[model samples]
Target chain A: MKNRVVITGMGAVTPLGNSVAETWEGICRGKSGIGRLTKFDCTAHETRIAGELKDFDPLRFVNKKELRRLDDFIIYALAAAEMALADAGLASGAAEGERTGVIIGSAIGGLATIEKEKEAIFLGGPRKMSAFTIPAVLANLASGHVSIRFGAKGPIGCSVTACSSGACAIGDAVRLIAEGHADCMIAGGVEAAVTPLCVAGFNAMRALSKRNEEPEKASRPFDRDRDGFVIGEGCGIVILEALPRALDRGTRICGEIAGYGNTSDAFHMAAPPPGHEGAVRCMQAALRDAGMEAAGIDYINAHGTSTPLNDAYETEAIKTVFGEHTRRLAVSSTKSMTGHLLGAAGGIETIFCMKAIDTGMLPPTINLDHPDPTCDLDYVPHQARKAAIRTAMSNTFGFGGVNAVLIVKKFEE
Target chain B: MTLEEKVISIIMEQLDVTREECVAEASFIDDLGADSLDLVELIMEMEETFDVQIADNELEKIRTIKDVFEFLKSRGTVWQE
Candidate 1:
């Protein structure tokens, strides 16, 4: 029999705040973490704003020597993993547990490291570059470094599925534990692509929001005025344990990772198929996997990246899947406040869904001043609402037309 | 700073160690907790600071704090102590 997988703990380092508590607080207030890009000069770039973390200290996760040796993506991944382990009450002994594992998802592994090292090599010789360049820039190093630090001996991996990377990583972890390959897994997604080169490249593609005048109001998901998605950086991780074992050990069960669905819209490389056919099939599959119906889900944390295409398409997809229940489902795009975390979007959005179920409150899609007429739905706009959300689903789609959906429900004995 | 002091200071900064760990007989690997990469970085830093490159073959010969001092002294670089 396949084991039941439950979430024991969660940790996050997001643009809104450093810890789960801080980030959740920001979300509940419909606060906007988006702001002007401060990582580099964006004079030449069309997009001048991004969602950079406030007052993040890598020292909390790694030593000084190690920090210089690692990249920002790895640091954020490690920080979130450490926090998750601590919350799960498995921090110190994780290294000794042969059954423990680590998985991290990232779209672009270490863009900052790559950008800086490229400049170094161009100015000096290849040998003049820092010895840590290779390890820092490799996308898999996010998982590799975490496994090394926590000494996880079981399965280890990194998911590079474009923007849906984190969701894919968590989905893989759920499968591993459910199939009895591992007892526990520290898994999540991270990104530090707020670099100059990435910004320029994304700008060249016209994929970023250029609303530099008011950064906070720029990410208006499902609203008619959303120009584009605000690029953001952050990490989110959760501790998943086999249900029987967690109950045996008397752990605080956050929720059950009831279902996950992954699908590829082979129709396009960067855009979804007309009417989001892949997304519709993916959501239907996730509900089936959960042994539940669309009516069972009380809320949905929409992908709602604030991009004109994504928000509109995602809303249409939701309508197609939920049909008559569309009116009852309290839907909101926490991305409206957190911005588009890309690969890390799934991780944080899943956490938001869990919080919604546990706390009985729904996070709002801020800046929804004027709802797009075609994208008709109750988006719980501008401010959070009090509600009894027993089950919530999170949706994340990536640049490769990859769609991933996860369902979390309140723990029931 | 003396040659010994200047070199030790670089070791302290490069290896992230304390002054006490920079004693004459302390091994870069065992005593100071340095790995292969750390040692390489230390050597690179010293080369940049001292303006003299150590031969690749000589890297194996220097394992302790004193070996670095003597190697630079052998280079006859103008410095004190």
Candidate 2:
């Protein structure tokens, strides 16, 4: 049998807040982080509103010089990892060197840096570009920087699967610990693609919310008036440790990572299949890995991106997987509050689900007015609920038809 | 303080420490808490803020804030105090 892995520390540099407690408070208060774009002028873009990190002074976490060399994505990851390390109380003591690993993923890394350098090259000569271009904007630098910062000597790597990158990273980290490759792993997702180019690309595809007027109510997942996702920036990180090691060190076990499953649709590049067969399979695979029945799960953090097609297909996928139990499951889309964090969605949502189980408080899927006729599940709309949640599943399906489901349960002694 | 000293102050500020914490005898990663990427970013920020182009070899020679300030000062870029 594989070893059990439990989450001991959690941190977030989300649009909701800079840390887990801050983000949770913001989420519980139903605060919306979406607002007008301040990074660039979005006069020409269809989707002007984005879930930008407001007043995020990077110097709080990283040095100014270091900030320029690394992309915003890496900054977010490192900051969140520092918070997680500190929270775990393992930042300075044992497990400081080896036996610790990092797997931080980003869907699109160093996008803003690339965009700026590309503009410089276009406007001036090649000599105008600085030498820090390549290392500043790569996908793996987030993990690379995290390892260097924290001195985590175990297997450190980054995964890039668009939206599923964060989930894949965490899932892979859990497997690594279970297989005895490492005793502890820092895993999560970070994305800093709140640039003009990203906004334009998604806007051109109509994959974003054009509700520039009402930014707060812009992301209405599962609602009949649902439009599209609001692009957000930040990172979410969790420290996973072997159960025995956690107990030995007296670490607080927030939740046990029961199962993780991932699959690719190979059918579409941007859209989920009609019936969400891939999503259904993904969730089922997780359940099988977890060795739990469908009726065992109490809450589900939906991949409800507020888009018309995604919300419909996710509803279908849940029903297809849970069947009659779908009616009994308490499902909600925290994306309704934090917006779609892209690669960071899976990690942040996983943290939310685990916290929900730990606290027995189900986060609400705010703005679920006039639910779509096709979705017939208890969405836990508008307000939080109290329930004894033993198992919770967090689902994330990315742009490349990549689907991932992670099952987490409250730790019992 | 000389122009070099003024430039060193900015480098120290960018590196996130005090003058005593980052000295001429210190190495970016070995002595300071900086990583490889942090050093690279420090070079870029120095170039941008000082208006002096730092070549690869010159950047490699910079181990501390003092080295950065001196290097920029030697390149005829006057630092403001």
Candidate 3:
């Protein structure tokens, strides 16, 4: 049998709030974090609203001089990692270099930094660019910064699978622990893509909600009036420890990472297959990995991005996976509350799912006033509900037909 | 664009502060809370603003707000130091 893995702690820096408690409160209250893009002026763009991180005083986590060397995503990663480590009750110097590792992923690395540098190059001569420009914006720098900060000298790397990056990173960490590659891993996703170029690109694709007038109501997942996803930024991380290691250390375990499944649709670049066959397989594979039947799942954190195709296809996938039980399952799209966090969606939604299982309360899918007939499901629409949740699954699908499903169950301690 | 105005605008934007925060005597690292990267960005902005090339050797000695002004003056850009 493979070694078991359990989530010892969790951390999140979401548009809803800076800390996990604050984020959870926002989720439970069915708050909308999407708002006018204040990171930069988006007045010229069609998509003006996004889930931007607010009041992010980086001075709380990083030194003044050190802040200049890192990108916003890296700064968010370090803050979340620090919060996770503390929540896990592990001191920075407690773990040996070989025993700990970091695997944070991002969809677009440091787009904001790149945009700034590009503007500099166009306006200034070659000598104007900073020496640290390349390293600051690289996709793998998030993992590197976290590892160096915590001295986690074990396997340190990143995954860049569009929006499924976080799920892939967490799944990789699970495999590492199961295969005896490491004892503990800091794994999740971080993204800070609230920049002019990023917003303009998504706008050009018509993939973002143009409901700039009503920012909070812009992201209406599964609703008939749903338009497009609201791009968001933040980092969500969890401390994954081998079961035996966690037990030996007498740590307070939160949940078990029972299953991880990944697949590619090979169908389209940005849209799911006509029948969502790949999504069905992804969920089925996760169930197989967890050694659990379909009926065992008590709740599902759907990848409802509020787009026309994704919400409809995801509902079809759920029906295919659970059949009759699909209607009975307490399904919700926290994206309705936090908006679409893109790369960080998987990690943060996994955290929410785990907490739902642990606390026995399903978070609501806010603004589901008028649901689409094709997207009909429990959806825990409009209000939070108390339920007996034993096992929960979080689903994440991304552009380029990438899909990842994680089965996180209540810790049996 | 006037080089001084151009440079000051970039500094204000990058630091996310106002002109009051960047008094002429303000050091990039000390008063503006600019780390190494911020300084680099400032230099990059200066280079773009003046259409001048600042070598590493020239960049190494720049410390205070006055230093940046004086260096631009020496380059024949002739701004108030």
Candidate 4:
């Protein structure tokens, strides 16, 4: 048997809130964080709304000098990591440095910084470039900065599998701990790509909702009126430690990471296969790895990105996996309230699964007044429901046909 | 503001230090806790603020506030005497 890994702490900086407690409260309340795009000028784009962070001042988390040298994504990652470490009560300096690692992923790193530097070069020639541009824009810097801040000297890396980046990172952290590479791992994802170029790119692909008048009602996953996803920016982090070590240290264990499955569709870059074969296989693999039957899963925090194709395909995948039990399962898409956080989706959604397991309250998929005929499963729509949840699964599919699924359950000796 | 005062303010802001810490004898790395990245950004800020170009070799010579002020003086940047 492999070493069991359990989640000891979690942190988040989402469009809904700046901490895990606040974000969970917002989720339970079914509050929508989507609003008009304020990061950049979206006058020419077809979609002008995004789930941008409100009142998040980086100075609260980082010093002014360090803030200027790091990108917004890195800042978000650092803040979330700090919170996670503090919650775990394991200061990086106090932990065995060689046995602690960090894996923070980002789909698009330093995009805002790149935009600024590119504009400077175009407007004022090459001499106008900033010296810290290179370090500020690299994707791995998110992990680098966190490791440096916490003094964690173990295996550190960043997973860049588009939207599945966070799930992949967390999954990889489990492998590292199982392999004895690290006893503790700080893993998560962060993204701050709500810039003009990102907006234009998604708008050009017609992958964004153009509901300018009603931003909150725009991201309606599984609903018949759903069009596309609303872009969001944030970070979510969790501290995973070996079960034995956690018990020895008397650390609080939120949940146990039972299994992780990752696969590639190899069909389309931006779209899933006709029947979501990859997603179905991913979930099955995770279930098999966890040594559990499909009927054992109590709730599912779906990848429902509020996009039409993703929602229908994910629903079909769920039905194919669970069959008759699909009707009994209470599946919800927190994205309905938080929007699609891209790479951070898997990380934040995983935390939501933990929350459900802890609280026995199933979060709702708000704005599902008229469900799509193809999506027939119970989505726990409109309002939160009270239910006993012991095991939960989170699914995340990225743009590059990458599918990742994780199964977490209530920890018991 | 005079050149010295302007330099002090920029150093204070870029290094996140106080005015007292920006003394002439204070070394950026030793006294002000600046890493390589901080030094590079400080140079860039100075160049933009003074509208003067600093060569790669000249960056090596700048170790202290006095060194930066002297380098600016050599580059024909005038200050209130």
Error at A188, model 1, angstroms: 0.6
Clashing pairs in 2: none
Q: Which candidate has the top score in DockQ?
A: 4
> TM-score, chain A, per candidate?
0.98, 0.98, 0.99, 0.99
* Native contacts retained, all candidates in order: 0.42, 0.33, 0.33, 0.75
Stretches of model 3 off by over 4 angstroms after superposition: B1-81
Whole-model Cα lDDT per candidate? Answer: 0.89, 0.87, 0.88, 0.92
User: Can you list the residue pairs that collide in candidate 4?
Assistant: none
Tens digit of lDDT per residue, candidate 4, span A1-413? 68999999999999999999999998999999999998887888788899988898899889988787789999999899888888898765664488999998889999999999999999989977888899999998999999888888999999999999999999999989987889999998889999988889998899999989999999999999999999999999999998889999998899999999999999999999988999999999999989999999999999988898999999999999999889889999999999889889888999999999999899999999899999989999999999998999999999889999999999999
* Candidate 4 iRMSD in angstroms: 1.3
DockQ score for model 1, please?
Answer: 0.64
Residue A47 miss distance in model 2 (angstroms): 1.4
DockQ values of all predictions:
0.64, 0.30, 0.22, 0.74
What are the candidates' interface root-mean-square deviations? 1.1, 3.9, 4.5, 1.3
In candidate 1, how many Å is residue B59 off?
A: 1.7
Write one digit per residue (lDDT tens) for candidate 2, span A1-413: 78899999998988788889888877777778778877888888888887877677889888766776678998898889888888888778554678999999889999999999999999976766766788879988998888888888999888899999999999999999999999999999999998988888898898998998998899999999989999999999999999999999987888899999999998999999879989999999999989999999999999999999988999998998998898899999988888899999988999999888877888888888899998778999888888888999999999889998999998876
lDDT of 1 at B43: 90
